[model samples]
Target chain A: MDMIKIIKPGLLTTIQDNGRIGFQRYGIPVAGAMDDFAFRVANILVGNDEHEAVLEATFMGPIIEIGFDGFIAITGANMSPKLNEKNIHMWRSIEVHKGDQLSLSGAIEGLRTYIAFGGGIGVPEIMKSKSTYVRGSLGGYNGRKLMEGDEIPIDASKSKAKVGRYISPGYIPRYNNNNVVRVVLGPQDDHFSPEAIETFLNSEYKITAEADRMGYRLEGPKLTHVKGPDIISDGIVSGSVQVPGHGSPIVMMADRQTTGGYTKIATVISPDLPIMAQMGPGDTVRFKKVSVEESQNILFEYEEIISNIKYRVENSFIIQETDKLYNITIKKL
Target chain B: MYEKARFLPAGDKSLIIEFGDSISPEINKKIRDMYLAIEKSGLDGIIEMVPTYRSILVSYNPLNIIYEDLCHKLRELEDNLNDSGSEPAKVVEIPTIYGGDYGPDIEFVAQHNDLSVNEVIEIHSSRDYLIYMLGFTPGFPYLGGMSEKIETPRLKTPRTKIPAGSVGIAGKQTGIYPIDSPGGWQLIGRTPVKLFDPFAEPPVLLNPGDYVRFVPIDEKEYKYILKQVEENKFTVNIALLDK
Candidate 1:
């Protein structure tokens, strides 16, 4: 059955999941949702497994109509999602049957938003992944972004979740253009001069126009290297701060290649990846040096939040629909 | 960490143990041994391990195994690293059709090195190149020990899409393109064997520390192997190299 028919593909929209793991050794990138926190929340709200696929929209979102009786929850960036020409709430689960239309305008806050169907996307898996890596043309919906009139398959909802199952406002992360992201130095920090490392930590970098799932190129103070900026090709994980010969930095992201030849000065922590992913071009971000322990401490806390969210919904989901549903008078557009 | 081995932090989830800075059979052998030991240890929380030419990047879950504890266990594994369980290195014979459209740049490589096309093929197929690591593209091997006679510079402008199974040489290096991708490597031949099948169980045909010997074949044999690969009936000829 056709789950989602794209009437209009807004910005860049692609299917994503937890990630394709265990194959990085074969030079396969672990392509997945950039904002994993939001991605997981969207899946959890619809009572789907944490790894199920969801629609990850960047900047703008797709105007899609559903052909299944299931649920949908929008998370991450607030794109002012609408159902049948009426405003729908973000970070909340809502009901819809076949022929119901869903659409999202431009993002007002975060850079990426996730629209998760009830049972998740039912696309054919490549290397056991639903996530799209466009550069390698592997996985997800035909290994590319959604196009107009494309009919996407969706797994039927096995979720007993009520219409009001939502995440509270306290749990919803806020995204800003000016943000501070944490970084842990290493792997190749010794390749840089001490003063260059200090420069990297102190300088404020703005996200350049070349930002995407592969990596976010940041323009800032040039980081000088003790030797030339080349390293023998090695495995690259997401959040690696690789400095090419030009001296600018690029934070390798989820869809990054398995290996790179440039020298990586530092790596951003996992907990801050979502925050970094939500940042768009021209956004100014300052880097703060944190130890692995301090960074891991935050990571533990972040994981704690996700584990507790599923049980705390329904009777008291965000904007708790139990008490009252917001009345909106639909206007003829 | 050992004296020559430098353990560097790659964020909270990964650790890079650099054994050396250059590519050699000895360093790669040590890496392969260490990789097998760590992989076979059944250590908890270890997600994946990528063995490069000189380093092995170990990705693990911090929630289950912190970097410190993981490093401690890795140290133990490193001390206990042995070659007892490792099978003898196998050489994968890659059947290739050289010259013509299959190797459009063979003439260029020949002229650059002052040799003929047959001499180029003779020099290229004479040795078993060590597979350093797979990177750049999926199943794309980083090979070592290419004959200096066949060495040539990469194209000034890279082709937008080089077909998969393209055998190429770049300067002091030579490798095959496992997938269709834009690259500057000078193409010299095309292999009929599929090095990467995303739908397969292992997906990749080559592994780190394996040796690849190119066996020159005619167009008929190339077409036969290509058909077998498409039909999923092609069993790669893997044999233990002579000790």
Candidate 2:
């Protein structure tokens, strides 16, 4: 089995997949990659399934030593990845030979970055996922972050295609310090005053330093509530913008609890979640209200684009294979 | 009397069906009834249904089933909820040890209530509490039905870490910590039963709509039960509640 030894385990690196589904009824959180877009793209670049487990590095990136020949792709944030002290490109697959060293530094743009291998990480799946839930101490690499001197097992299966596959330039996501995120109002919009709702949509909020995989606590205008912010405890979904008595909004994330008591004023759409996840503590964010239909339409459009890209990549690979066969035939003649 | 149910959109992919405005047994029954009805409907693309105090959250995949179609199906199912054949609540007896080292805040609880430690224990153990939901942490039950006499405010500052199985009271709520986590509730006792075990099939000992009763035990019994639990020999006392 191929393995990668961690020489320096950056800030917080953990293995994550799409998420743990159908376990929230048991109070288990659906922990997965914070930036799902980057995770899927990285896997696709390396010829792996979209739901394959990848290493998610927060803020900083790890230095890994490859023990076997394989392909790897790094996506999401530009962490200035280097192969044997040489600069490498993001959004593309790179081949690694035995004893090659891959290192990455601090992020240049976004918060989290994803590193994916050709055959995914070989971690044992608990509850049908490899996503790490660090709080529960279950799933993914003994339920903990990667540390120095840790050996990460990589699946030995390799893609037959040559490495260096890259995503289209149009498909690459761009991040900025200021992001405008769209939301759909209310499971509990009635709890807040109309003025409060206006304030939530109009005002600018700064992501607090307490942001993590669980939730992002935003500091902004105080949203006054007509009634108390408390509600009968109910289920909370990812991107649910909850407001407590303090009036600031908390955007719940992948590792949020199964339920909460605070009133949720709005929920960020799935398509906009990657932008929200890429935001750092000092980043400024503004919310724009959209209807439920608009949110669903945006999701549909995003999925359509992803499928188109997949189709193009498959067609191009087939063309390259035919070219190679024609060259061999001409040489034989 | 049947209360009118309101369908509120939680997100693009999920909806919340609220039974009523307050937390009560009647509201909880409706929530459970709706959950069972939806489950039996065999609705495709339904991800999971979470039953809380007065609401049931139905999450689904938008790609598989649109929101309007799902809402229509759920409304049709709600009309037949009375005939959904909901299961009866399960009564779970938890073996607990009050005061001493296990419950560090027992003295404070007794003084706050102006009662002796034994009186506090008796009042707490006498009534069966209903499990409204499980959240905040894995298997941590949010229970209702603590008498007003034992009502205590949460700690001014939450402890950095509270041991699992510590029975606590915060306002009118009493619950057990399913895992070692930071909590603010005033601890009054400790239970030997494991509320959460990942190795178990269900992972949680109590479910929403279940009833729990605390059975007071001595320190010796606590140790014995703890040993039995460690060896997987202790079984939680469970019985079907009368409808």
Candidate 3:
């Protein structure tokens, strides 16, 4: 029954969830949130399911007028969100009343920003996901970006948790103009010359403006292949750093096709994918190769941190509640 | 023939099993066999498997299964894979309309190959092409085994939007555009078949290891088939290939 009307649909805002899984075999891309870390955190802050669909805005953010009271959270990029002409902070939950206008300016720190509601966006799920594949015209708000004057329906369920819950400072990710991403050497590393591999690991690459949900095209040292870069067309997974005949490496992202013909020299680790997603045009990126064991360990450590946050929050909340109860009892006595 | 496969890490969560180095029928068959074998194994944590020309990409969840353990299981499955028991490849006949508004580049493809348009059509539809893989777009088939006589180079500048179901030839390969997308391949004909329909159960009409043959049709027939397809009354003519 709750809804928000878009006054201005900034840049490219679309609904995204965890991803459409189990459909890659049919060449359907696993379209999902570009920055999973921010997406998940936003949902968590709002007391919604981690995989719930959220609004993913690129560079710029939309201005929407709420029609009902609801809880909301914005994460990932800092777009300088303002509620009814008042400044709001990111990485925290906020409550909105009826007729409240929420607007956001251009991103200051990162490329994509995620905005989530308490009970998730009420969009029909296609192939078991709400992620939008714009090219295929499948899933999410009519399979396209939010346009001006679109009324977005939100789930009417209310959240029991109080608003203003902020992510721990320790868990906050740092965004910058330069990033050093970790990767694991390849499914097709042997196709590239040793010198080329060294160049890929040591050289600094700039993220080109052509970067999108499909892939990030990096402008850097020309990686010379021992043989041609063309391989027998093979499977491509997200974060696979594929080098085409042109020698430029394209880091496949969430909306990448299921298979490609280019040789992949390496793949970025899962934990470091957030760092890659937040990068904007002209952002400098350098690669550091790590072993498979090291990458897996990093992912395990990241998951451990996320899992601990919930327990820590619950314990703190319980302690505060008990202290208040004790004070009330003393007053009664 | 079954060849030794090398396992390479695609990322921390996925691995690629390279069966061979070439794009041949034998390599494609092995890829399909391995895919079925792994599927039949009922391996936990396996998210999805993509079958390509000479490899199979298996993506998994690291939280549910570790990388080493998955590789071990896959290796065991590969070793015990029974290729003989695998289902025979299906031959799918596609009704295509050649050389008209639908196929704008038909003349270019014919002239480039130094043949008449009718000859080009005959050569293209003669042999059953193998579906090497499905990629680029949903349901788009990367087909192999095009006749050498019809080999034509891709356009210098790619078209902004090639219509869906357009059968195209580029270099030595031919493929169908399952969705309207930008492409460089020379369009030789257009098929009325809906190769990709998101509302359908399978979504993609063809799969890797299947055989596709182009059956030429006139404009009237094309219109009739298009109507039937829109009504969901048209079924792709398929037959089990004899080994």
Candidate 4:
């Protein structure tokens, strides 16, 4: 029964998990952490399930005071972090003593940051998720952002683990400001003018100020659709780059609506979604079109490597340690 | 006889079954029929199925069902949709306000159509709008039934944000913005009622295949209805019709 009290809630911080599923039918969007890769990595660093509850901070993070000793890890954007006025490195697990105050400044680079607890941040799950959908006022921290004087409870089971284990830089996700997202042709890509499609692939688009978790409205060359081809409304997915009447493309992201009527010229591949999530306004993005098969192969290879690494780490935990220094001679006897 | 349907790839995880290029009751019925038949067939790995005016978008887990197989299953189900169209539909009435801040574009609509605001409201309120399909947002009904006399183009340089409950007319169609979202539809009026309430058992006020009627109310009545909704004292009336 330990808790963390928020002394200063920076910019926009909210408790999130993988997001609320099974409620899309209700018109409720699946609102969760903007960067799932970083969110999951922070959880994995502390031996917690990748989808366990965690804190999703915007460009700026919170100043928190731990009420009890615990292990924590920070991931995603490189926000300078200090614990009790001592500088701490990002992407590594650290032990916190009770009464220690942790402060995170504005992100020096990147747009989002994930904070994960060893046992997971304790929050009631609504519709099977702790992610907050602020529009509907559903899920997470009373369906709102974390504020000053807010005290969030931590799962007591997490306190039993031995603290002070540090994560190395290798575990950290590197954020690239100039991102080139890989994409595949959408269903309605044929509806767009051939020249427009070619221009889309060849040009570099700048992320405009009109951006949010729902989608990023890009400002670039006008992408015109074929004269007689108007797309009807249909289901939309994250990473779908839709072109509205204005001729600008909006790349739908995590909090995007489930459906739309705009013609989608391209969809970002699943593997490159993490890189896109880290991008902020004014960032330039180039879209590289790849075949569906190639995109799937990339995703498959990434998953295989992740699983293999997890297998090695989980196996290490089960192996017994030997006291080799005490006995120089063979112990076959 | 209807035209042959085409299957297009929606994304890495979905497929769009296009009935045709145009909107007609025939195509709309086919889309709904196909959706119902596929849903009842219990196609494995089909996570969610959405129907629009002319196409049905089926979303499935790529890990569970391959793209080719999902379409094959859909084709198998499409053959059985001829008999499902006889099912009944649920019709709903939605009360709304048609002038003032709720509907700043009311006068504009009147001016564009060469009719008075009262006549415009009368024409809009009298017709039964068909729910083509829900899209753009959750529980947001894309209705089809506005007379050409009252139809108006969307606002130029669209508002950055339109509050939820703002009723709008865009081109030939009209829909209520169930959530406070950025949009370009010309606002005709607003409603105090919640078009979508997540806390309710069925969150969306109107479902696909349901008919909707807009009843104009005065400002005093709008405030009264708003309070009634907050206090859970409002009851929505409906007229069931055979498909």
Candidate 5:
């Protein structure tokens, strides 16, 4: 088993996967890759399961040395990835020889970037996941941030292919600084005054620097919610736009607390959360109200695309290894 | 009072069992009763059950049971709650050092209510608190019970980070910060024990429906306990409560 060694931890780097889902009941957050699509793309490029382990580097990327001969891919934020002084294009497969130096820099396009290897980053799994949750100190490299001198084991798995077919830009999520996030009215939307609701949907809010995996604090017109009743605490989901008494809305993210008492005006459609994950401080955000049907339709559309991509990956491997890439056409069962 | 708990859709794949509108102890009891009932029911498709101050959020697989079908099953399970028993829970005693840098805000609260620090400590430690919920952060318990004199508003601007084991008060509720995270609660004191340890047999030190009580200890005892904690040799004194 070969491994990768960190030379410099750029900004904030941590090992993450699809997160620990079963432990949410224990008050453990689902701390996973912020952008699931990009994480999967990186994993797929390296010929690993979409849910395989990967490095979720925040703001900036870390300096690493390849410990083995393997393939890797960079996705999510276009952080100007370079290999031994040679810039490498993202979203495609690249070979790294033993001792090859790979470096990632600050966000050239998006907020977070993921670098996945051929067999995924090998780390001790906690609660059936490699995702790191710093609050509870569980999962991924001992549930902490990647540091210089940390040696990350790499599975010595061989992947067969080069010049891997690229994912269409339409399939590759586009990271936009000024994005209109679509949301559906939540259980407590009526708590806010009509004017507050209008302002929430119409105004442009700037992301404050006090943002993290837990929630994105936005700066906008203060919203006064007419208390219909004191809401008892209940479970909250990711993308829930919760308004604390401060009148500012905090858009909960992947690492949000399991439950909350703040009144939620709306919840961003699940498909759009990945887009929000790539947003950084100073980014402007706008909200658009959509019907329940519309939100489900948007989610369904993405699911169809995701399943199609999975189909391609699963079948493409079979074809390449057996020389059946073109002979066998996929048919839905 | 509500007769039956209804299940509402939390998301496409999750359902919520709302017991009532208010945060009454009875409602909390019913929520716990229903949770235990469902646990005994051995219902399929439930991946997780998160109990809050007054509701239980049940996350299930839509592929196995759609939200509508799960709601029907939950309705069926509600009928079985009459036989549910309030089982005795393990009570954990926590040692605290009151009135110092560890508890800087204790004097402020005591003075506001025209009471002495000893009185405040006595009142707080005398009553048994129920763990209505465990949330806000990993291992942080939303304990329900406090002497009215100690109730205080949260700091105007929350500290960017509060160290784990810092006991704090916010309004009528009191909680301990289980991890080093940002918080707004008024600090009253600190505890030496780990409230949450992922590697432990049970990740959370307390669960909903569990009872907790604070035991006042002097600085010498606190230092002795701190050394024991460092050596991983401390054990909490527990008294089992009868059902």
Candidate 6:
């Protein structure tokens, strides 16, 4: 059984996939990759299924010692990945031999980074997902963040040893401190005064230090509500924008609770959720309103691009046999 | 007669069907009724449906079905919704031991209401509480129908950690904590029955729309049930109640 031994578990690293879905009815949250785009690309680059479990590292990353010959890809927040003390570019799959050391530094741009291996992280699926819901202590690597010296098992059943897969630079999203995410006014938007909704979209809200996988509490201009802040507790989704009595908005993310009592003003669109997740504390964000129809169109476009990437990664691309620039040949079956 | 349900789109992936704005049995029943309808609709792209106090969160795949089509299908289901879920809901009796170490806040709850601890326990355990929804933590039931006589304000300072199966009263509500987590509800008693066992087949003991009846037990009975629960031999006394 091949595995990656964590020599140094940096910051908050955990195994995550597309999340524990279809469980919100039981008051279970859908905890998945905060940045879904980077997670999928890393898996595609490493020749794994799009939803394969990968190492999601926040701020910094782990110092892992490979125990077998395989391939790995890094994406999302650039954590300055280094293989054997040499710098390695992200969004590309690299082949490695046993005993090779791979390390990553603190984030240079985005808040979280994902590391995908040819074989997915081999954690038993509790509730149909390998994604970690730390608050609930369920799923993924003993249901918590990776600790030092913890040898994470890699499911080699789906391992593909080939490498040299890279995503086009144009396709890789460049994360920045200032972001504008699109949102759709919600189930409880009527609870807020017209002036409050205006303030919410016009004002720039900075992510407070209270940001985590569960949700991000933003500090901005107070949002006035027409009705009281509280609602009969109801189901919560990943991108639901809830406004409590305090007037500040809280953006529910991957590890958000299954239900909440606060009135939700709006919900961030699916296409721009990756951007919302990548925004770190101290980062400022502004909202752009979009219709549900337009938002679904954006989602279709994004899905189409990923489908194209998956096709290319599985069929196209010439892998270089060696370090020489001229050793390119078509990928062999 | 109930008002027409409002269909609100929750982002791109979910749609919220709000039956009403109040927390009552009628609203909960409406939400649960719609939940059953959507579940049996064979509606494409609906990943799952969450029935809350007054709304149902329908999580769907945007790629499979568009928002307008999904809404149209849901409206159709609502128009043709059946009242079949009213076929005698189960009443799960949770055996509890009130006061002493098991219930640290029992005294406070009694003092706040100016009633004897025994009276408080009697009032709390006398009636059936409706399970509105499960949320906050896994299997934590949002119960309704607590008597105003035992109503008490929540702790000014919430406990950092509350043990699982602790029956509590917050305001005009009484419920149980399914898992060990942070909460501020006033603990009136503790139950030996496990409300939530992640390793169990269903994970959670109570289901939405079920009636919860707390049965006050003695220390000896509590210890007996505790041992049985630890050995996984204890079964919650559930019986169908005719409305």
lDDT of 6 by residue, A69-120 (tens): 7889899998999999999889888887789999998999898999998888
lDDT of 3 at A259: 84
For candidate 2, the docking band is: medium
- The reply for model 6, stretches above 4 Å from the true place, is A321-333
Instruction: Kindly list the per-residue Cα lDDT of model 3 for residues B63-82, writing each as its tens digit.
Output: 88888898899889888877
* Model 1 pairs whose backbones collide: none
TM-scores for every predicted model: 0.96, 0.94, 0.93, 0.83, 0.85, 0.96
Give every prediction's interface RMSD.
0.8, 1.2, 1.0, 2.3, 2.4, 0.9
Tens-place lDDT digits, model 1, residues B112-199: 9999999999999999999999988889999999998888999999999899999999999999999988999888899988899888
In the predicted model 5, the residue pairs found to clash are: B103-B188
Which digits, one per residue and each the tens of the lDDT, describe model 3 over residues A203-320? 9999998899999999989998998888877888889999999999999999998888889999999888999999978999999999888888888887887776654433332113
Number of the top DockQ candidate: 1
Q: Relative to the unseen true structure, what is the C-alpha lDDT of residue A28 in candidate 5, on a scale of 0 to 100? A: 79
What is the C-alpha lDDT profile of model 1 across A113-197, one tens digit per residue? 9988887788998888888988877898888999999999888755555566877679989898998889899788988999999
Q: Could you give the CAPRI-style class of model 4?
A: acceptable
TM-score between model 5 and native: 0.85
Residues forming the 10-long window of minimal summed lDDT in candidate 2 chain A: A324-333
DockQ metric, candidate 5 = 0.43
lDDT against the true structure, each candidate: 0.89, 0.87, 0.87, 0.78, 0.80, 0.88
| Clashing pairs in model 6, backbone N/Cα/C closer than 3 A | none
> Which regions in candidate 2 have their CA more than 4 angstroms from the true location?
A158-162, A318-333
What's the ranking of the predictions by DockQ, best on top?
1, 6, 3, 2, 5, 4
Candidate 1 second chain TM? 0.96
Candidate 4, DockQ score (0 to 1): 0.38
Model 4, A1-333: lDDT tens per residue? Answer: 688999999998889898866656545677788886778767766678878888888888899998777778888887898999999866656777789998999998898888887788788877678988776567888888889999999874664333333333464567777878888887788878789999999898999998888899998998988853346667677788999888889998878776777888888876777788888899999999887657666767766655654443333322124733121221334
Chain A alone, TM-score for each of the models? 0.94, 0.94, 0.93, 0.90, 0.90, 0.96
